[model samples]
Target: MATVESVKTKDKKREKYIVTTMKRLFKNKLAIVGLVIVILQIILALFAPFMTAHDPAAQNLANRELPVFSDGHWLGTDNYGRDVWSRIVFGARISLVVGITAVSLGLIGGTILGLLAGYYRKLDAIIMRFVDLLFSFPGILLAMLIIAILGTSLVNVAIAISIWSIPTCARIVRGSVLSIKEKEYIMAMRSMGASDLRIMIRHILPNASAPIIVFATMRMATAILSTAALSYLGLGAQPPTPEWGAMISQGQDFMWSAPHLTIVPGIAIMLTVFAFNVLGDGLRDALDPNMDLQE
Candidate 1:
C-alpha cells in the first residue's frame, strides 16, 4: 500500500508536468494570438449566413463600388455591386474546404506509401525514388502543371495541391516509420506473430502519429495558399462564386479606385496563413514534450 506522502508526491509530479507544458506553450505569444485569430475566422466562416445581411452573390449595380463606410455596405461593394463583406464571409467556406480536403488526401496517400517503403526495405528504393523525383520540381510549379492538365475546377484544385503535398508528407512519415519500426514494442509485436499489415497499421502508425499531425497542421496552410494561387490563375472556383482567390482576382482591376476590395481579401489570406503556421509550430512543441528538454 502507498503512503499518503507517496501519493501526494506522485500528484505533485503530475501537476509539475502539466504546468511545464503550459508554460512552454504560453511562452509562444505569436502562437497564442494566432490560435485566437484562427478561432475567430472559423466562427465567422461557420456562421456566415447568420452574420451577413445580404446574399454573397447578389448583385446591385446601383450599390456597386461603394466605399468601406458606405451607407449599406460596410466593407464596400465590388465591381459587380455585390457586398464585399458578404462575399468574404461566404468565401471562407471554399478556402476551408479546399485546404482540409487537399491535406486529408495527401496525408492518406503519403502515409500508405511511407508505411510500405519504411517497413519493407525491398520497396524503399522504388517508392523513395519516385518521391525524390517529385521533390525535384518546385511545389507550386508542379501544382500548376497538374492544374493545367486537369482544367479549372474546385476538385481539380484540391487534386493539384494534394499532388505537390504528397512528397513532403511521405518523407516525414517514412522517416518516422523507419525510427518507430525498429523499436522494442514493434519487435515484440512481430515476435507474437502479428502480420506485417497489422503491425504497420496498429503499432507503427499509432507511434508515428505525432509527426504526422505536425505535418498535417503545416500542410493546411500550404494547401490554402496553393488553392488561392490556383484560383488566381483562373484554374480554380469560377466567377459568381465567392472564393478568396476569385475575390482578389476581381478586386485587382479596381485596386486604385476601391482599395478595400483588394485589401480585405488580402488581409484574410495573410491572417489565415499566419494563423495556421503559428498553430503548427505550437502543435509541434506541444506534441513533442521532450524536444525542449533535449535542446
Candidate 2:
C-alpha cells in the first residue's frame, strides 16, 4: 500500500511537471505558431492517402504543367501532371520520418557516448577527438559522403543524417554531463556506494535531459533539410517517392512556365524547417534555468 501510494505521488509530480512545461511552451507566440504548423504537417503525413484530393503519383500527360488553380487541381500539376498538393501532403511523411528517426538514433547514440566521455576523464580525449574528426565535415557533406558509400534510399538517408547528427548531440550531451557530473548530488551518490551506471542513468541523465530534448528538436529540423538536399541530389528516395527534395528536383525544369511544382514543395520545406526552429528556440528559452526567472 505504501509503495503504491508512493508511486501515485511520483506519477502526480510527473504529470504536474508535464502540465507546467506544456503551459510554458504554449505561452510563447512563436512556439504556438510553430506547434500549429507542426501539428498540421503531422496530421497531413499521418493521413496522407486520405488527405490528398488526388493520387500523388498518378500522372496525366494532357494536364502536365498546368498553372496553379487550373481545373480541379488546387496548387497545380507537376511535369507529370501529378497533383502538387497531394505530393506536398504526402511528402510530409518522408520529411517527418527522416527527421524524427535520424535525430532519435543520433540522440540515443550520442547521449550514451557523451555520458561515457563526460563521466570518465580517461575516455574524454579519445571520444572528443573522434567527434572532432566528424565535425571536420559539415552535416550535409558528411551525409552526402555516407550516402555515396551506402547508396540512395530512404533508410540510407536516415543513416547518413544520423551519422551527421551524432557529433552535435554528443557534444551537447557531453557538455551537459560534464556540468552535471560535478554537481553535489552526484558526489552524494558516489558516497552512497551507488554504481557509476546507476548514478549516471538515474541522476545525471535526468538532469541533462532538458538540453538534450531542446537539441533533439533543433537537430530534427536540420536532419529534415539534409534529407531534402540529398533527395534533390538524386541520392535519396528514388523516383516517384514523393519526397520533398525529389519533388522539388522534378519541378525545376518547369520552373519558368509552371513554377508551382517547385514552389509548393519548396514552401513546404521552408515552412516545416521554420516551424521546428521556432519551436526549438521556444523550448530552449522555456527550459533554461536562467530564463526561468527572466520575463
For all candidates in order, the CA lDDT equals: 0.88, 0.88
Error of 2 at 196 (Å): 1.3
Which candidate tops TM-score?
Answer: 2
Query: In model 2, where do residues sit more than 4 Å from their true spots?
Result: 1-19
TM-score of each: 0.90, 0.93
* Predicted candidate 1 versus true structure: per-residue lDDT over 141-171, tens digit per residue: 9988888898879998999888888888888
Candidate 2 on 38-84: residue-level lDDT in tens? 99999999998898779888999999888887878878888888888
**Superposed Cα deviation of residue 179, candidate 1 (Å):** 0.8
